[model samples]
Target: MASVSNPILVTGEPYTPGLTREAVCETYGVLVDEIAKLGSAENPLGPSPKALIAIAAAMGLTEQYPSWTAEPLRKAIAARYDVAPDEVVCGTGETEVISFIIRAYAGVGDKILMYRPCFPIYHLFAENEGRVPVYVDMGREMDFRVDAYVEALKSEPIRIAFLTNPHSPSGKLMAEADIRRICEAAGDALVVMDEAYIHFTETEGSLHLVKEFPNLIVLRTFSKAFGLAGLRAGFGIAAPEIIRPLWNIKPTWNMGHMQMAGAAAALTDHEHIRRTVDLIVEMRGYIAQRMSGLTAFRMVPGSRSNFFLIEVMDDRLDSTIVFEKLLERGVIIKDGSVSFRGLDKRFLRSDVGSKVNMDRLADALAAIEQSL
Candidate 1:
């Protein structure tokens, strides 16, 4: 018998996440409370209290399978977004839904349009499926490359175009009007808008675009504001025609019982969501204020999202070096160079943490500056 060959793996830079407290403890022997995790844009307030309770309640039903369709959670999400329940599709997370959208629409060798330095997963999944990723560079300044994107949509045989709203690792939000313009030009292609961090901003985002654009698929996640990252809860909003194919590709019981129940409970806890968003918004201001006072670093301006990128002002300072130093001091921030495309090693991306945590980070930076 002939030996089987190994499965082909997609090649690219793997997402380098912030260090967990446990990993830090093992490496540097620091306690969990000593660490301020400002990476991955998690809710600073942590998971929703109602979600915790619901998850606990769901533990009793572990032996049974989750609802095949997750109808209750879908209904809750539909109500929140003002779309029909059938127009929504629940998944383990927004990433899974994105995979479904990409696979459902684009096939092997089909062109998929993406802005450089986008949510890397979008490119990752497309490449994994053997789809060609056509890039429109965001250029040197990381400005929104709307003209480039529109040109690609019109010129290429693009099936899927992924846009990250309040874009990750930088936090620049693409306005809804601009998104509408892209949708109008996309012709036959599906425009996937990943709004995982949309709750961080005050605006409603491009969910409304789905109503007017049949090819628009809006993805939202509970991982950000709902603080349900560990549970892996999220949904997609699209017309029933678009959603039907996604449902066909999704595995039965893709979402666990606890995740669905926790997500549903989280949806009802609007006050908790409000608090989480308000805290991030408030700290975004606080962090920017703190950065202004620092001679060593400055934040990248114009981010309306919860987290923003910080560039070390000093020519000699490297963000990866600062990242290691901060990790030793129990503060974990993402080294921006490794996380996204087109970023140099001088920058770091961090979400707003609690007051005490932020203070510790400030102190850590100060100490590093003194040493330099």
Candidate 2:
């Protein structure tokens, strides 16, 4: 066979490293139907019952196109925060909105700023959109450091900045004051805050900040707390003029009718949000405490979110090995090297699942320790 490579293959084979169903179940020599199955690692609670009901009601509307403006959902979201509907726009997912924001504001040779160890989608969108992504280090000891970010902005010519409040992998929440400082430094640049994990944090408030900073755009998802990942619905909040440009670039009726209806229902179910957030908080404490006692790993301090990054001491074993080992035993985790630089082979990020699945993961990790 002839050897051929695509221009995008800067790194070998994109490296999915994910396990197949057969492989996942086979590793422990068990049937696919019976494996403990924590590797897929979505919300263990599944879709909200209210969302399901709404989706069911919208079934007949499948004959019709989704609402282009998503007017009803926008109004619902606005009412939740007492904002004007003009300030909101919905998308297929938060990732799609992020790409739209970057594309709408900047172009070839333009620059976008984001911190290191961020969601990989930001860099991917920037690179493909023919723009430069200027990355700032998130600081070694702390997940978010205002001084370093200010320094980066001081030196870089940034047209836009994407920040994840209650940042992923690290699962560290940023303070309101620090956010204001960042907004101040960006000068004329638009700040895109990815609050995908906002529901998981209690102390930080983002909706209030948008009213103060016209440059601020907040991206939120129903995928996490509302359990609507499968429906692919997320929305962005910004000044109407800022969001207006996006409609020109984005697909009209991109979100399905079912997803729009479901999202609106999810909003009305405030009790569900409260209960889900409370559960995550309790589980986070349990996991953090347990991980703290594990002498084999080092975790980031003061995590106030649903996921946490860990550094494994055994340098010989790569994150892939750790991930695959856990998968075999039915526990799945995110590998951090996808977004960050200088991550040792031992680094990995685990999401908080249901208590039952979490217990299985803990036992699996405990057993894997003996093998390692």
Candidate 3:
């Protein structure tokens, strides 16, 4: 038989998502209602009311194809960001947009630049496309080393560079000045700013940087703050010149009726967004305070996003031990050894959850520490 699969995909490191509530419940024999699902950086408040209404209204149209370009969503995003609609490209999720950019702008064996521990999709998508991913080590504690990225951008003939602000696992938000410095250094390379968690922070974000840099693309998603992770709605903003190719190459009717409807409606639901941000901020603080009293682990500082990391300081426990113990206690979180590259057995990642959920996690950790 002829080779059935592409070797790159057959051998590639597949993306591993956080465990779902059902899986945890099944494995741990815990009731669904008792599980504290802090593994995924999901909005604990749930979907926006306006978005729920819009999605319900659009459900009947599922039999028909959606707008060829998800026009309403594009328009909504454009209007909110003060950009031309033509400059926006919608996708199933920011992951799809990342894939599209790689397929459209990069070719086989081309170079892609990214930080050592980044949103895994950047490296995974590049590898799948047969592009070479060149990694720049982040500063200690996952800080964005702007000078290192600038040096890499100036030295390499890179086709694209991926930067995740309020970075995953660590949640450190990069300053605008550093971002501008990297953008300036990118000569012919397209710089993709993945701001999936931007809403959790107070910074205004780098959407305006797109207007200043022709090679810049700003990606945002409804998955995080808008509470539409299941809806899978995301879009990218760039100069029309850069967006034209992405739009041209994207799948026709990429977003379904409900996805587009929910996302567009969610964009205007400012109150829901505010509540989500506030909840994350408040719960994160609560969790931080709770973790501070524990001797088994310490919460990594500098997190401005919804999720933060916990580093195991006690010799008797590692991330794997804490992870399994938390699972036994019906608290699900991402074990850094499995979820992220460049991290080890000492770290685990948890997203902000409801007060009750945080209390469950805190109580579980306290129990574990007392046992130790």
Tens digit per residue, CA lDDT, model 2, 1-372: 654443333543232333445776656665675444433335556778899999999999888876688887888889887889999988987878997898899877798887887777787768766688887777675468678787877788888988898886677888888999999998889999899888888754587788889999989888888988879889999888888998878988787889888998998787787878888788777776676666666667766777777777665567777777777676666666643553556678777766775676667667767776
| lDDT digits (tens) for residues 225-307 of candidate 3 | 99999889899999989988888898877889999889999999999999989888988899999999998888999899999
By lDDT, the best candidate is: 3
Query: Per model, how many backbone clashes are there?
Result: 0, 2, 0
Residue 33 of model 3: what lDDT?
A: 90
Ranking by lDDT: 3, 1, 2
In candidate 2 the C-alpha lDDT for residue 233 amounts to 87
**Model 3: lDDT to the true structure:** 0.90
What are the lDDT figures for the candidates, one per model?
0.84, 0.76, 0.90
Q: Give model 2's clash tally.
A: 2
| Model 1: per-residue Cα lDDT at residue 309 | 81
Model 1 RMSD, rounded to 1 decimal = 2.0
The residue ranges of model 3 lying beyond 4 angstroms of the native Cα positions read 2-5
Against the hidden reference, what TM-scores do the models get?
Answer: 0.94, 0.91, 0.97
Against the true structure, candidate 2 has what lDDT? 0.76
Query: At residue 86, what lDDT does model 3 achieve?
Result: 92
Measure candidate 2: CA RMSD: 3.4
